[model samples]
Each structure stands twice: as C-alpha cells, then as structure tokens.
Target chain A: MITKSIMIVGVGGQGTLLTSRILGGIMQEAGYDVKLSEVHGMAQRGGSVVTFVRYGEMVAEPIVEEGQADVLIAFERLEALRYAHFLKKDGVLIVNDWRIDPITVVTGAAEYPENIIDELGRKHKVYAIDAMKEALALGNSKTFNVIVLGAAAKHMDFAKEDWLKVIEKTVPSKTVEINQKAFLVGYES
Target chain B: MAEKKIMLGNEAIARGAYEAGVKVSAAYPGTPSTEISESIVKYDEVYAEWSPNEKVAMEVAIGASISGVRAMASMKHVGVNVASDPLYTASYTGVGRGLVLVAADDPGLYSSQNEQDTRCVARAAQVPVLEPSDSQEAKDFMKFAFEMSEKYDTPVIVRTTTRLSHSQGMVVLEERQEVPDKPYERNIGKFVMMPGMAKGRHVYVEKRMEAMSEDGGGFFVNRAEYRDTSIGFITSGIPYQYVREVFPEASVLKLGMVNPLPRKMIEEFASKVDKLYIFEELEPVIEEQVKSWGIEAAGKEIFTRQGEYSANMLRRILLSEEVTEAQAAQVPARPPILCPGCPHRSVFSVLKKLKIHAAGDIGCYTLGAVAPLSVIDTTICMGASISSLHGMEMAKGKEYVKNWVAVIGDSTFMHTGVNSLMNTVYNQGTGTVIIVDNSTTGMTGHQDHAATGKTLKGKTVPAISIYHFCKAIGIEHVVEVDAFDLPLLEKVIQEETERDEVSVIITKAPCVLLKGNHFPDVCVPVPEKCKKCGACLKPGCPALTKKEDGSIAIDATMCNGCGLCMQLCPFDAIAKEPK
Candidate 1:
C-alpha cells in the first residue's frame, strides 16, 4: 500500500553492486517508481557498504532510514550485524553466512563475533545461509550474491517468472545460465 | 506514456548536457562526478575530454564558451578550489555562450578530503547556483542553467551533493533541443580582464547579482508548496526530499536555485507559517541567508551541520516523537582495505619493511595507513604528498627527512605533483618522490589519465611517459622499478632517499582491478611448510589469513599472483599455482 524500502548491505567487492543492479532493473521493469542510493568513492575498498532501494507508487527519499526498511539483504555476516538495525520491527533479514576478517581481526585487536545468526534470529526474522558454499557448489564463487538475492526473493513482491526474465537481460551473456541456476538454488532453498 | 528510464544523477547530468545541445565538456575524474563525463562520452555530438586537472578543465570550458558554444566542466568540490582561478575570472568576463560548471559536493566526505559547499564558493564568486533534487531535475536543471546562463550573461554553476550524484532515479527521456550556436562577436571590453575593463565588469557583476536575486523569487526552479501552516521548512536539493518524507503536510519553500536565494519568496513564506525552520546539509548556506534577513529559523541548533540529514532527523527534531530505534549489534569494524594483490600493497609492503615514513597522497595507497602496513605518516590532499614533504625538509633540513619519502599515484602526480616537483627542483630542495605508477586512477575506479595513453572518448593517443616528464623537468635522478619485484624495489627506494638532490622513483605496475589484466598463477598456502610465524601476514594482504589450525591460508580467488606474501614468507610457505 505504501513505498517499500529494501536495504542491501555487504562488504565491498562482494558483488553488492551486481545484486543492486539486478534489483533496480527488476523494479524499473515492473513499472514501479524506484530510486536507489549508492556510495561511490574511497569507501568501496572492502569497507562495509550499503545500497538503499525503494519502490512504490511514488518514492520520495532515496535512502532507507533507520528502522524503515521493509527488507534487508546482507552478503556478509558482519555487515548484516552492522546494518540489521535499519530493518523494521518485523522486517525480514536474509543474510549470507560468511566471514572475512577485517584488519582489526588480523591485527588481534578485535574478535569476529560468534553466533551472529542466533543472536539476530532472536530479534529480527532472519534467514541465514552460507552463500559461499552454494556458489562454490556451482563451481563459480562470484555468483554468491545472486544466490543470496534468490533467497530474499520469496520475501519481496515479485514473481519467479519476472525475476527469470530480468536475470536473463541483466547478467552477461556467457554467465546467464549459471546465474539462473544459482538463483534457482536459493529460490528453492 | 512518455519513454522513461532510470539512471545515475551524474548520468542524468550528462544526458542534460547532450539534450541541451552542448558542444564541449571537459572534466577531471573525481568521485560522484566522474560518471558525468563517462556518460557524456556516449553522445557523439559533444566533444568531451578528460583534462589533466580541474584548473585546465575550467579554462577549457571558458575557452569553449568564448568560442560561441554551450560548454561545461564537472568535478568534485575540492577540484573547484583548483579551478577557482579561472572560475572567478569567468564570472567577471561573463560568457559568449551559456556555460555551466557542474560541481559535485561530498557533504558526508564519502570520497573527498573536505565537505565544502559549492554554494559557498558560488556566493564568493558572485555566480548563481542551481541545485536539483533528483535525476529528472538533474537533467531539467542542466537545460535551465544554460538558458539562465545565456539570459544573464554569467556562468551558471549546477551543484549536486553525493546523495544526488550517486543516487539513481527514474527520468523521462527527452529529445535533444539542438540550440543554434551563438555568434562570437569581437568585444575586447567584455572579454578582456585588464584593470580598467575589470573595474567596469565588477559593477556589471554586482548588477547581475541584484537582477538574478530579484528574478530568483519567481524562478521556475524555486517553488512554494502549502499544506500545514503551523510549521514550515525552507529546504533545497536532497534535503527537500527529507522534508517531504518527514512532514508531508508541512508548508515548504523548496529553493531549487540555492545561490541568490529568493528573498521575497522566503519572506512571504515565513510570514505564512507559525514557525519556520531551515534545513541544509554541510554548511548553513540557506539557513544563514534566511536568518540574516531578520527572519527567525531553527536549524543547526537541533540539526547537525556535518554529514547527510534524513527523515528520521526531522521526525525526532520537529515532531518530537519518541521513535524507538533498533539496537545495532556490536561487531568488528570493517574499514576499507587495499585489494588483494594491489600493486600499492606491494610497494607499501616494501616501505613498511624499510621502516620508512611516507608523506602519502590520495588514491588506494592511502589504505597503507590502515593496518599491519601502516607506513604513511600523513595524507593531506592530491599532490600535498610531495609539497608537504618539501615543507618538512625545508622545516627540519635534509637530515630530518633521511628516512622519509613522498608516495603518490600516477594520476595524482599528473594532477598537481608535477608542479610541486618543479618547486622542489627550483628551490634546490632534496627529497624523494615515489610515483606509484599504477597506470590508471585507482581510487576513482581507474579512469585513464594522460600517462594511460587513452582518452575519455576511448581514443588511443600517445601515452605521456612519466619518466620522460620527470627527466625533462630537469630532475637529475629518476628511475623506474617493478612494483612486485620486492627486493629490487626495496633497494631502489633506499638508494634514492639517500641521494642529495631531488629524485623520482617510478614504481611500474598495472592495477589488479583493471580489465584485461590476467594473472598466470595464483598463490596457495602450503599448510605443512607453514611455521605459523605470521611474517607473511604483516603486509595485511586480505588473501592471507590465519586458520584455526595455527597456519596461514590463502584465498586463491583474490590473490593476483603478485607473490608479495611469498616474498615475505621466511619459510616459503606460500606457493603460486596455475589457475
């Protein structure tokens, strides 16, 4: 009935932009007034990054405010923990269960928290999956974001056929089949 | 229904330039503004080129305007400071044709050194500024700015914030408005800026400001929307969107023309509302003006003058609602790091090993200040690395900088480092400048510069050799070394810094992220040979991590086979394998 805001949070270089592009393409094709806000600069160098996607009859603000996100998709466990607060009280959180040590962890200054999924699952509705394992099963680790996006698709307001059509047009020609397969693996999970 | 598409604000700005019949566009690649030229090049009609820096870009646009054609230059806010020399003059001289300068301001410091508002600069130069709220407006305002420029005979600045530039929104496509080229008439009194002519032009500039300010009240870009009179917001650009989101029914005077703010419209709106509030990010450009008119407005007292503002801010401030925010989970911080196998990592690794302090410049090399590779002592701006080092040497003499060197990227070296290099040579200063020649602008996503031998329009030109540029500038000692060859690089850095005269050491390596860059091998960890001593992890390459088994593991996917980790490993625990 109102504008739906989706927040995509992930570590930079983890194909966060690809998933945002796919979502943007789908939203526009669906004839919704969509706006996506992204950060482009020095921050993309493996820092925690976010892309806000909002669509509805009329979208006003580009950024999804704290506690206003209807859905939040994360590509890394730490990033999910970082931005999970942006989700609404009953918002759905689909997260990839993966770990990449930050410089702090490498330097022994901080510890990567344990039981992040369990902690978040107790608060917000959480769907945690090891997307890296799924992508590795597909023989290409880079398609992990497509798998995560597929898992989150069931929560969004789009049909399977619409997703398939957009995916075909969005991805590169050579990787279309693999991305399709990757999306289905998460869709059926 | 009209055909519409979603694009970046930068892209929309480019489309606006194309549709308005712009003939020439020049820019220097900086974040949030780089994509403008990237998109502008797709149109075959416009002759777009990426100049060496922003000053050159501003001059190019001024020259093009004087040649009787609509022209523009785009850059991040700091670049405007470099180009302000010509910008201030262009304001006085006016334009032969409509000229627009698109300055993208980074209010949140997303990718910039400072969060300076371009509107502040506009007020100083006495130029008018038009700010758009969304993608469609980004296009519409560009066209309007040209018309406004030619009508007023003054250069127009179309300013956009990071939120406006990087955001993507739906925009209705439009046909090109093919404006006829203006005839260039010989008017020395108007074009020339000598003392006598400049004095007359100064009066003309003041008159233009007065006229623009009066017209600004009724300008199409400025609008007054009425709903609730109890509270009102006078906002512009992206902040206007927040007012809509937070208080949909509140009366608003959305000032699209930020500079030369509509005084009459603002006063009238203030009279209608019971209480008025001014909302602007970065600097209080709007609030200060509205307040100076003896009108009361509540703004920075409750709102921050730093970073981006949002709907939630207005909700908590104006509405006085107790909004419960979800508690953010505590987690390890993930700061931006150098990409695995980045050539800067290799060079920085050697610098860290030599225990040398570096006067760092911008680019991916700035990340060297982060973790285990923390060798950079300071990072001021683009070319401040060399100049600051010269300052340090001049301040403390040559003996103080015995263990110091200036590290800069190739693109930054071209930007302003060359000028600093000449200053060092002319002033008889002895300092070492390491030109980290990664062959592209690494930080801003690898846009080709002069040394890259490529143009913004994808044309292949004779690449300017950095080595020759250094030698031709009368620098006596200059050398080129492979970035990945750790031993040789270390030796070269040591020899150069020890020298008496000014020297340039060019480290040659292509950025790992560049397209068509292929690695013949991948680095793998030999678990059995691992001593678990952690020497290889000192460089802080993201690919090397400590496994629970007390051994280092290599992420084969991210490694570029640069062998920096292997070179660092005392036990030869890491091996390069064929992919």
Candidate 2:
C-alpha cells in the first residue's frame, strides 16, 4: 500500500473536519491504517481550517508537511490559494470557486492573490469547480464539501464503492437518501 | 441493523454518553467540545446544561457522578486549567458512577487561547486517556470511557484533539439507554479525600492503573502490525495514519490508549525493529514514555516540534528522499486570521486608532492583535483581559496611557470574565473594558451561551445581561454602544478610558450570520457627491472598494450597512440605504 497524504483545506463552517472522518472511515474499513489530525475548538467563526488525512500500512505523522500532500481538497477559493503551496508538484487540487476573505484582507492590510487556479496549476494539477453551486443545485449548499470529496476521489486509489459504504454506515437514516444521492452526484460530477 | 448517522465528533461524544446511560451532562461551550453537551440535550433521556464556566461544569459533573449514575463533562483544553482544582482531587476520590471528562485539544492554536494539550492533564490526574482517531471511534470510546470509569472506579478521560471533536464522520448510532436512578451514595472516606482516606485512595489509584494497563493493553485498543523488519514506528492519535501513509511496509504499534500507555506492547514492538521513531503531535508524550522504558526513539528531531504534524512532515522525517522543492512551499509559514465582516473587527479598529494598549482575551477578538488592527498588547487566556487591564493600570497609573481597554468577548466574559470584573472592582483601578458581545460565541461556530439566552438546541434559556453584571460588579458607569457606530463608539471609549473608576462599554450586535439570512445591510453609493478623499478607507471596511476614478464605492453585495464609513467620510461620500 502506497502512503497517500490528503489535506482538506477550507474556511470554517465548510465542513472540512468531516472530510477526515468520512475519508478515515473509508480508509479504515478498507483495512488500511489511517491517522488523521485536525484543528479543533475556536477556528469555528469562518476562520481558516486544515485537516490532515494519511492512510496506508504504516503512518507516522498526523499532519501533511507543506507541499507534501498528494491530494488537496479545498472548499473555498481563498483557502485553496492559502494552502496551495502545500501541494506536491505532482499532486492534485480540487477547489470550490468561492471567496471569503480572511480578517487581514478584510481590514485592507492584505489582498487575496488573483487567479488561484493559474497559481496552483503552475506547481501541480488543479481542478476548479463551483462545488457550492453544484451543492446548491442539489438543494443543500452544505454538501459542497462532499461534492469536492467526490471530485477528489477520481485522482486517488480510494474506491468509490467503499466511500459510499462509509457514507451509508455514517449518514442519518432520515437524510440517507439525499446524502447518498449527494455523494453519487459528487462522485459522478 | 443499527441506525447510522452523519454526525460530528462532538455529536458522537453526546451519542456515546447517551448510550452509556449518562444521567447528567454539563459543560461550558468551548470550541471543539461544545457540541457534545449540546447534542446530549437533544435526547430527552438525559439532563444537560451549560455551566457558567468549565470549573463550574466540572464540579457539577462531579456532583452528579457521585450520585452513582453515569455523568459527563467537556471543555476545550485551557478550560481544564479552571477545573484542575476539582480534577486533581476527583482522581484521588475516584467516582461513584461512570464519569467521562472530554477535553478537546486545539493543536495549531486554531480557535483557542493556546494549544495546551489535554493529554498532559490526563497524565497529571493519573487517569486513563482514550484518544479516538475518528467519529466512529469517538462514539465507541465515549461509551468505553464510561465503562472503564466504572470498572476501574475512576473518572475516565476521553481526550479528543480538535480534529477528532469537530470533524464529521459517519457514526453508527446506538440506542439510548436508561440510567438507574437512585439516591446519592454517601461514603465520606472515599468521596471526601481526607488525608487519611486520600493516602489509601492514592495507593488504590496506582493499583488500578496497573490493572487497567495489563487488562486494557491486551484489549483491542492497543494493537501492533508486524509488516517489515528494518524500521518500526510507535504512534497514536491522528499521526498514526500519517506514519502509515509514508512507510507502508514498516512495522507499527498504533496506540489507542494514549495514557497509561501499553508498556508490554512497546517493549515487544521495540525489540522487533532495528530502529524506532515515536510519531505524535504537539508534545512528545509517547516518546517520553518509551524513553523512560529504556528505549531510544527518534522524533522531534527530523520532524518538527512545533505546531501540528502533517503527512508531509512524516514523509520528510521517515522517507526524506520523497520530498521535493514544490512541496516545501506547501507548508504554511503564517497562521490563519479572522474573516471579513467579522463582528470583532470594528472594536479592534477603534482600539487600534486610539493607539491605546489593550489587554486582549481569547475568542475571535484575539485577531485584533494581528495586522491592521494590531490594537491588542497582550492575550493571556480567557478572562485575563479585565484582570490584566486592572494590573496594567494599577502598575502603570491611569494618567500614563491614553487608552487601555480590556477587550473581551461576551462568551469569554461569562466563562471567566465575571471574576476578572470583581477583581477590577475590588482593586479600585480606573480601567475600561470593552465587551464585544456578538450575541453568539462567534469564535467557535457561534455556540449558544448563558448571555445568548438560548440553548445549543435553539431553545430559549435565560439571558444574562453584561450591563447588569457590570453594575452588579460595582462599576460606577455601565453603557452599551453599537460597535458599528464609529463616532459614538469612539466617543464612549474615549470618555470611559478617562473615567476615574471602573467602567464597561458593551458593544451589542448580532453577528451577521446569526441575523437570519437577510441580505447584509449594504452602503449605497452616493456617486454624484463623491470627491473620494479616502477618509472612509481609514477604517478599512471590506465593503468599501476603491474605483478606477479614485471614487470610493460600497459593494452593496458585501456591506452589512453598519455605516461607520459614513461617519469617517470627509466629503459625505458614503450613506446607508434605507432598510
């Protein structure tokens, strides 16, 4: 089993924390060792958050080193750029085309750089999608993270079926149908 | 088939507690750990409440635990500092019923006052610590924590790092169980922890640790994989996955029970590999333990000792050849800041412009210490603002500084700010405190609190007024100011700073998100009278964007229409559109 490091980056409230859990569930069920670490408590006010997901036969660290992530899943445009440098040269990044400037940018002390896709593309393979729009189209703006997760799977050895099982096992029975369909849309998109 | 639910780690702990027959739940909403009790209250079976602070919450849980049913309490890491008085004693006294204390550690200082790991607390209390890697484990371990609590007759700690608590995963929900209700069991010798009883309980705790390690170690919680011979890795918590990601063929010992670590498992694993590296985040708790057992491990040497450990860090530490130049850039050199339209921005701006040294407390308000605002001088945990301000003023004298306001959030004020206020009154120092009450915690996903008059489940609870609290604290003057009202806020702050005695100015505004999805109030462009002197830009509201003609324009799309810019506009170039 090849060691694969997945980094989930986004503004708080974008459900970045769930990525590690959902992804870990799939990895753990696949009989692979999974080690994940995330920022908790506080960073919840739409602050920037990053979660590190690593899985294989022998994991060592909880976080992905800068620029060492094999896959970068971003829920917001600015966060994609903020963490863009963490992607390895041969890595893949799936970004949602939404911008929520951080406090520094808001106070006019700094500005978000232009053309995040172009910048990320310079170092690694980049896919920019309006995941939030797709999620909104599906009637839940909150599921954008899961949509990005689906798009992210296309680049990895992570089995689509296994991810579905985890989702089925984890999602509430009341919203299972919607979330299952949501995951399918994300996977197929 | 058991029902499955999509739940966050925070929710899973509540689910775990409910299934474990938890009779009572209490906590103060701190990030990462807030949702545990919030979700517990959703189930009609358990009694849950939000205490004023973590110390109170801990005492309340202890009181419930003594009654012989299951009980649980949770708080963010630093919160444990407040509850330590009871936590240390409770470990010696042990528990009458199952008690699970969940302390969510925020590595990377995400939303906390500091990233003090709670694993240390577990070790210090001489209790068992279960660190769950995911939501499923979070749920399972919570129930297990309670079980271990009762079996060992001790308070068990389910230690969750921020990632494990806030992260959402698929949790297989269990049916809620009912706890046996009975009268309190009064065993003074065991519960009181008197010097005589304490010595006996202390020895019992040591014996319990030995039994738990021997029995629980062989339990599935701590397991080993014999994959390859050359290199062996010992790790636990979230880093276990990262180590596996890099060296797929390496032998590994992944520890689920972090505290009272499996000594037998470690020695066996160490003997198998030619070299060993203990991979863990924050501090070297596991590394130190292995070393104490006469094992030389490599960690915090090749890998970073600060912030958080990432997969990239693991690869570099274990497989150095795999790293590349582009990967170097991916590591964030700087930390994240607050977001635009943040409720804390205006208060910081006022403090910055006045050039007054402010003692800032934790919460979203701590961002005021960052660039542009840079108004805050010190940030020392929660409730330190008011007390620190009093100390600074008394030592420096009131006449020395122009502005010296203690900036604190509404939730933080209630958490420990009450005591700070009382100290300010007793000390009789002339200082001003700005309570930035955004109507929610605002820093930690806007969790409800005592001041909000709402429960986490959105039920109405009694609200505590900062104004009334200030008056009760013996402040001669107490007033409220709209934080977005720049001129009025500035005048009020300026006057309060000059006051001869204690004063408090409450900044009242509902966070834009909590305002119920109405389009944020926007500033209308007065295109005709625009000279664009750039005076409005001084306050640096993101809603105001400069145009090509040097005329300032407000993005009706982005503005919340607070109109502080209107007051700052020298040429009357800005105004708020009618609601």
Worst 10 residues of 2 chain A by lDDT: A100-109
lDDT of 1 by residue, B212-290 (tens): 8888877889999999999999889999999998888899999999888888889999999998898988788888888
Compared with the true structure, the alpha-carbon lDDT of candidate 2 equals: 0.77
Worst window of 10 by summed lDDT in candidate 2 chain B:
B326-335
In terms of docking quality, model 2 is: acceptable
Per residue, candidate 2 scores C-alpha lDDT tens digits across B517-572 of: 34345677788888867777655555566666878766543566666677667677
Candidates, DockQ? 0.81, 0.29
Which regions of candidate 1 are displaced past 4 Å? none
Point out where model 2 deviates above 4 Å.
Answer: A1-189, B4-6, B325-343, B515-520
Model 1 residue B115 CA deviation (Å) reads: 1.2
For candidate 2, give the lDDT of residue B186: 73
